[model samples]
Target: MITMSLYSEKDLDIELLEEKIIEPVNKTNESKHIVFIHGFASNSSCWELFVEKNKNHYIHLINLPGHGSKEYKPYHLIFKFIIDLIKKYIISIYQNYGPIILVGHSYGGAISATVTHELKEINENIIEKTILLAPYSKYSILKVIDKIKLFQIKNSDDFMELQKMIFVNAEKTVYELEKYLYKKLSLEFFKKNSKNLKWVILGMSLPSTFYKIDKAFKTIGSSFYFLFGEKDKLIDNQKTIQRSTINNIQPYFSIYEDKGHAFFAEDKDRFFNEIENIINL
Candidate 1:
């Protein structure tokens, strides 16, 4: 199990993320290795609540490449880079550890799904279960702009302002520790990477949706499932709503009525309850 403290202002650039992001924390000696993947522009700190709740299980919090640090090198397309990095990490973990369980939020969920899909295709028993929260696959989230501003940054100053706005906007919903961590993600990207937010976002989103998922559906157990809010603006797109039925796979999802995309942050008790139920099962 591994843990990366997202709130630390320590020099994360010194170490390659391959050597730093995975932190091993013991849930219990006999427990299945449980992994947590965070959302876009987010870090491992986002799972603080879940980590605290599942202290008895072996836990691994993954801070994806270019996140929780200031070491990003510019890349025209980083989508594949991130997936490949995670895939390598997962492979390594499986070799050192054993069968596993996965929990992910938002974009992280998509990544978890895709990674699990690949692993299962290779060896189905390696993946125990996957719990995806508000994962967006098969649709683009570029249009969720009314409450949030959507534009590219021109320079570092513009990027800082954007980060400031996000911190301000999420002031009420986000946790204090995570608020600071989010700021770091934006700043690191601006300082070390390019100003093309759209390009980065597209790179992350497109492949998650385009990847084949039939195996993902077959591999994940009913104990693990997807959680989505009917009110989530990000996934409430026209196409998402029309083909949103998961009737054939109802056992794999849980739809919340009034919650939004930030359900975990918005209601920790409810979110933790869902996670506890799955892990407990």
Candidate 2:
């Protein structure tokens, strides 16, 4: 019943989100809403494939402040600003649509999980499912050297190197998109906002931050599921699960043996099939 335009670049004056990241779409009668949150340094457009694949369902793609076309304001530096903004958006969506599914990738996954926990405290059962893809919660499994390389990108070569860390293999469209993505990342726009973006990431990775996420995953039960790539360079499936065990949490998760951190981007068809099965289940 509610949908955000998937084709618009126009800035939105709404306090929830700064701009319209997608173009307007034909309204559907479906009551189910699928909300997607993209990863760090990524925009709502990352979910364009998912949107196109589920054109018939109501969908909302959230663009975090400073990501997409959003301007980086002083308040955007705080992690709570993002978590609260998305929680407010989700509540508003539930008021219109009956219930919704929340999906987040990487950093977005951490935010989504925390927000879901906050919602649960208020006794809101509007989120039918929460799917996290290679979520960046707690300290990363990446080695110190590789992690440093990922955070500090000085050139296109560095950017491509980061891409390699994200994807299992950079063949097909992934290869083509990297050039264009690097160009954008190298622009003055990205340069200006880089500090704020990095701050947001650091804020999200705080031990206090992920403690809440772990609690959320534990309490939310099976409705909250984690899907990770066993071969992921950024997040090690075994280490992540082992950490969860240490926290006395048993997570509902799956590990794709041959995939990497951005497995969905690598093999979308198979990814969507997995998504379809999760939603159907």
Give per-model CA RMSD: 8.2, 7.2
User: Each candidate: how many clashes?
Assistant: 8, 9
Off by over 4 Å in 2: 1-31, 141-146, 171-173, 176-189, 242-252
**For candidate 1, what's the RMSD?**
8.2
Superposition-based RMSD of candidate 2 using all C-alpha atoms, in angstroms: 7.2
Name the best candidate (by TM-score). Answer: 2
> Which pairs of residues collide in model 2?
5-22, 5-23, 5-24, 6-22, 6-23, 7-22, 7-23, 8-22, 8-23
For model 1, what is the alpha-carbon lDDT of residue 46?
A: 68
**Candidate 1 residue lDDT tens string, 1-281:** 99653222232232334332333355356666777887665667767766666545667775665564434544422555555566666766688888788887777776777777777668877768888887655564453444234334455556544444333235454435454465455555544434444445656645544554323434444545778765666654344333334434344566666666656756667887877677667
Of candidate 1, the 10-residue stretch with the lowest lDDT total is 5-14
> Cα lDDT for residue 87, model 1?
65
Off by over 4 Å in 1: 1-29, 73-77, 145-171, 174-199, 205-224, 237-247
How well does candidate 1 score on lDDT at residue 178?
55
lDDT of 2 by residue, 40-111 (tens): 777776776666666445667766876756556655645666776677778877887667888999878878
Structural similarity to truth (TM-score) of each candidate: 0.70, 0.80
* Model 1 CA lDDT for position 259: 64
Model 2 residue 251 CA deviation (Å) reads: 5.2
